[model samples]
Target chain A: MTAELPLQDASLVQWKPNRDRAKLIQMIVKVISGGFAAVSILTTIGIIGTLIIETAAFFSEVPIWNFLTDAKWTPLFSTQQFGIFVLISATVMIAFLSILVALPLGLLSAICLSEYASPKIRQILKPILEVLAGVPTVVYGFFALLTVTPVLQFIIEQLQIILPFIPDLKIFNALSAALVMGIMITPMVASLSEDAIYAVPQRLRDGAYALGATKRETVTAVVLPASLSGIVASIILAISRAVGETMIVSLAAGANPVLGFNPFNSVMTMTAFIANTVKGEAPHGTTAYFTLYAVGTTLFLMTLALNIFSFWFVRRFREKYD
Target chain B: MDVNEPTGGLEQSPEFVQDLEGRYRLDAIFEFATWAATAIAIGVLAWLLISVLIDGLGTLDWQFITSFPSRKAERAGILPALQGTILLMVVVATFSFPLGVGAAIYLEEFATDNWFTRVVEILIGNLAGVPSIIYGLLGLTVFLRLFSDITQGPTILSGGLTLTLLILPVVIVATRESLRAVPDSTRLAGFALGANRWQVVWSHVLPAAMPGVMTGMILALSRAIGDTATLLVTGAAAFIPFSPDGFLSRYTALPIQIYNWASRPQAEFHNLAASGIIVLMAVLLIMNTTAVVLRNKFQQRS
Candidate 1:
């Protein structure tokens, strides 16, 4: 059984979608990309908008000068002096303490991981550190509250006998939160610093070794210095993370915003204040609701500046291996 | 200047004598410190896991998993919280996956070496560094407050949207890296085969980049799961007795519920919080492991 074939028309061109289809796709891609970029920019703009609107409302109700200079930070109970310095102080205090702990531990861990530890060991340990990072900050909050606070209380009590200057530190204060936050951000700094250190070429290490330098000398003089920018950036990023941590400080550090720098005392951070007051279901146009936005704006600017600065520094100082 | 050197040259000195008394004491100390650091790192992980495991092991049961929270704390279950968390992840993934992939594709395939695109890239990178709490603020103000009357602010939708923002940068970075790893020749081949630009991207490029995208999605979802602050601010109700009814329904995630329970004065509540931690950890591990395995399989296949 033979099938009959139809004759082709010689005059007509074969039907094909115009090459403009590519251009059409390109246009679609362009729109999509523009949309993605716009979404990001919009988020940043949204932050600014919220901050300005809320802060303006707050300033109108309670003078901006008072919010800046007043020492007190009680909005829930009274309309008097709603200064945010206390909150800023608390945030700074905790951040400073966190950086204190994180800088040493994180830098040292990075050093050990990059310069000292075997690759096999790093393979096993890096993931463990990441897992630590992966543990919910809420879990860290509990750890701070349930475990570390009691331990601190016990230590402070024990130390009081030997040292009269211990100030009778409370367990749930800036110190504990800082310590926990430090622990939380250490893995991040360490991992990134290790990457930076490793990026320093092998020739630098070999050069140091060839000059009769010990392994420690090679790391300290050659690798560490070479990776300094990265290490700094890593530390800065860690500090930013530490500053921005919420649940840990909010849960562990007591919610009393004070303008003092005593690590022993309970102090509320900017994040904690935002978290607490925002939860109270404030009247929409009220000063309290606007204060959340103001605080958020402050936090946003602080973090944004840190990130931009760190990225710039890292990029500028990054060693060109090739 | 030569502390390790003996009265004669250190090379001529007895190896045992040098070993016993050496400046490498600092080296030993350094090694010991490194080991200590490793031990401490491991110890913290163990401490966290054990704290949760010891407290929650017996209480974690089918009933606990399936039941709703009761006014009577003892009779309460995490069913509502668990369900909310799962639903929130679904919603977050729904938004994040496409947005992340699209951003990644544009940066990798379509973007040229231009100032505007560079600025966009920088902005995305900067956004990634913004704190999750800040994202919470953004979410609360934009998604919740702006649409509160419309969507009744603090719904699962708002929370999910906030989390999508939190994870978007991470997903973009991962997806872009994966897409960049794909060879340029494949796109050329597709184009040569009479494929349109979209066809080349959607058909050839994306399939090659799928594993990476999936891996990034897993990571982004994992991050979303662990995040509580943004969700909390976005209006995850402190106590939800039942799973959310819809997108606009109030929600409570495991982390938030855990944070709530842990903050309470009751010891039983603390135990429940620990149990929640165990559940959270398990979920995170599963998600990450799956991503890693999938990535490995894809790498092998490719």
Candidate 2:
């Protein structure tokens, strides 16, 4: 084409290749990528859609109020009861117990990593601490059932001798579940909190030290406050994890879906209920089967709400720091 | 800088009724407690593995790994369940890896910082936090019902789809990190050579990011392999005799199979569960090592 055209100026007689093939490839790539994005969004929509439909079926069969407030949860027996409060109560109790045990230990571990330990020590210990996360929950369940429970029983037996004045001083109940849940979530809380604490400006620590404050005082007074939001978020995330945990409670916390406040007595959690039902010989579409959906919906909502709250917290905290 | 001089009170008291001996010494107490905490944390790993091995090692053998499950725990082998698990993983990886990586690449390379994209990012992050059980319910309703026409009942395909959703966010995030690591100048240089955006990305970005993508997929797959709750809800049967012939076949993963056997009252079943756990642990260890090695190898090159 250049040769056929008359050259008005010799300097303008240059040739470049057409990019039709490259442009076509670009269009294909764009479509493919756009398709992938669609799939991701669609999948999430599918999840939310499914949960609502099944949960709606569950609510229609068992009234929302009954599911919320009913004390007994015996969907498997002849005398069927559909109260979910027992499950929620147990879940909350175990979660609370776990937080009680985990929060202090997790916080202390964070402090050690961020404030006390040298960088060399921090690098070595962090991954080791995280190894706890790699251990399967079922294994933890076995430990809690076979080992932790017996140890707790021994302690309770001893405590019963001296604390005879205190009724229900035995340990193989809510307390044990909480203790193990805390252990399960400790890695998450500690690692996240450590990151938050470490994110606090070094200048803040320096200023506190410059004022003749001890390292301990500086950490507690300055760094802790500075990283308070992140620390709270970490704790909330840990709580969420504990609440959603299954195997630990299923194995160690026992399967009686009793609504009670006593830590020493056996109780059931929402997760434990679902696991129990799934293990049972219940036919699909039965009222019993629907119970699992309702439990799942509740558990999903609880975790989602917590996660959303934490996300907001982290965002706000980042804005302030940045 | 002014500093305080050392106090003489401790010297005067000598070794008799020292502050460290008689009273609560904060430093010593904290140090001791920290060490105790560290010990407990490490002790968990050791305790779990040791106990599981002690109980499960005797029951675990080549026959046990390859045999079909029976009413009697000792007679049962894990052949069907093992096959099902392998099939499920392959399907999950096949579907999830490409789409997840593509979405990640789009977000990193193409998407602008706008409200819609931001929302997508936020949704993905939130999805990552959702419990595995919720994914199970979704599978029960969506895949099991919507795809019932395809499978007719609960099937391995449903379980794979459910696991895919569970791990999608993870793979996307990992893929995005890898894509981001590619130098911008590399893309620019390709573009300067009159190559279109696709050519630049395909020939330069993806190749450079392959190791990272592979590492992330391995990590995500390892997580899926260990997951039992979602598969359990998605209708993994307790007994799968033969390997899965197709997506519609009823499936059983090692974890669930082990759980079924473990929950039984028989002592032999308990040993079998331990054996199952060991196999699961071995798979996990291999996956973790691969991730480490790939990450390091690519990191050195970059």
Candidate 3:
């Protein structure tokens, strides 16, 4: 609170440093502590450096245009196409599906836990939902491939009879991966939105009720609008999560890299592309090996953009009720 | 506003009252939707837990736990993966806990709220959101490449260091929260007794905050254990038939191994993957339960 001072305090203070010796020791302590804090900055630098150098090398060999415009990504084949979107389009499709499920379920659940539930009920349930988040993405991947895909296949088969136009469903389809990805991200959405929901002042609700608003009307008209920015931030962050999610998509979403609109068709995501491509040893400095860094850079940029926006929203727009 | 004379003044007709009923019914529907939403989230968790158990419990045996990984599904074990995971956790916990706690202490207690500190804080926040796979790339190029002789390229050490980085931001955030929970009066009291800032923080604040810090540490390790994309990208050996010998040795963790098995076309491998998940979940459960208990203790104390 007193940090506004230009110099050290001249006024009488209750506890003052005894001498220069004490001041020296304090300075040393501060430097060491600050040094530790600077490690994160060092980490950021290292990450950027690694991504840039390798991505540069990859881009030098494969022009930037092909990385964007080329529809086919066959880095391993004799006839190669360096189109990155072969992976991105599929990634976007799966992420889209995940957000579709996550938004409604996550937001409503957050509202439910924050608004509708009694304190006792909320205390019991919130932790359980958190545990859902704690379940590993790898385990979710296993669930998607082993359990969800088969179920989707069965349902698709039944649907195909009526809508014979339905394409043959692949076992490693994007739909199953997207579904479980939605579930995996649900806690992120629910917990974040719950915080935003909880932060909406009780007085707002009380005021609405005094104005003869029903429970639904009070929540929708007062609490929801008040916490709109926080809720939006939660969703954008959740999208950031879904976009970067790897194991679930890699395991369930097939490695085919088809640039198609069909969710039932097997397609590879950028993460999946990076993951599945590495099982076979590509010689060092080869284009195939360098592709990893290229994809890594793309994935990093996408997430970084989303995260920066999310953080901006959270910091700038959140209403301070107090 | 004479309420008894409502028919003459403010009384609602049957039509107005019916409109009110419509809103009340909608409110009731809204409540039920919220309840149903909560139930659906819970229901998914229940189904996930039960299905894994029903499928996995049969294969989770002593041999499965003790023996090394094998080509045959029946003989395959998690010994190498378990050892690697433990080793990785050891590296992460040992190295990161101090760094993270120190960073937190620095941010909370020592540093002035300057532009540099603000930048550091913002960087940490962004780092937390960066995808795990990018960290793997960083490890590959930085630790594994720059310090090639040290890490010996894509071994347990590289993976461990990568994980250390991955969990650092989280550990910092957790430690800061715990430190903040230590009331200011404690610091004032320590200084009143002629304790220096470092002394007060080291002697009083840290000890008071240790349980919450430990809880955060365990949760961080659990998170590191579940990670796969990073390990895979860092070249975790998918088929290490023998146990890893040291930090420099090629190794696999539980998640990587599970992913390896799950990706295989054979039906039996899927079952084996399920069994591996059971083990991973068991460990996670213990760690999380401990964390929860410690957190509750910390909450009670404060």
How does each model score on lDDT? 0.82, 0.80, 0.89
Estimate candidate 1's alpha-carbon lDDT, on a 0 to 1 scale: 0.82
lDDT per residue for candidate 1 within A1-322, as digits (tens), equals 8664333444333655677877887788878866775677677677667778777877788877887888898877665667888888888888888888777777778778777788998888888888888888998898888888888888988998898678866756888888888888888888988889888989999998897767776777788889999999988888788778899998899788888999889889999988778667676777677788777777877887888889899889877878
Q: For each of the candidates, what fraction of the native contacts does it recover?
A: 0.49, 0.40, 0.76
User: Which docking category, incorrect, acceptable, medium or high, applies to candidate 1?
Assistant: medium
Candidate 3, residues B46-74, lDDT tens digits: the string is 88888888888888999999988888999
In terms of docking quality, how is candidate 2 classified? Answer: acceptable
Compute DockQ for each candidate against the true complex.
0.54, 0.41, 0.69
Highest-scoring model, TM-score: 3
lDDT of 2 by residue, B1-302 (tens): 33465556555656744443323356456655655666676676677779888988898899998888888777878888778888899889999998899889888887889875787788788888887877887877778777788756678888898899999999999999999999999999998877777788888999999999999999899888878778877788887777778877888888788777766667788788888888888878888888889999999999
Query: Which candidate has the highest DockQ of all?
Result: 3
Which one wins by DockQ: 1 or 3? 3
- Higher-lDDT candidate among 2 and 3? 3
Model 1, which residues run further than 4 Å from truth?
A: A1-18, A169-171, B1-22
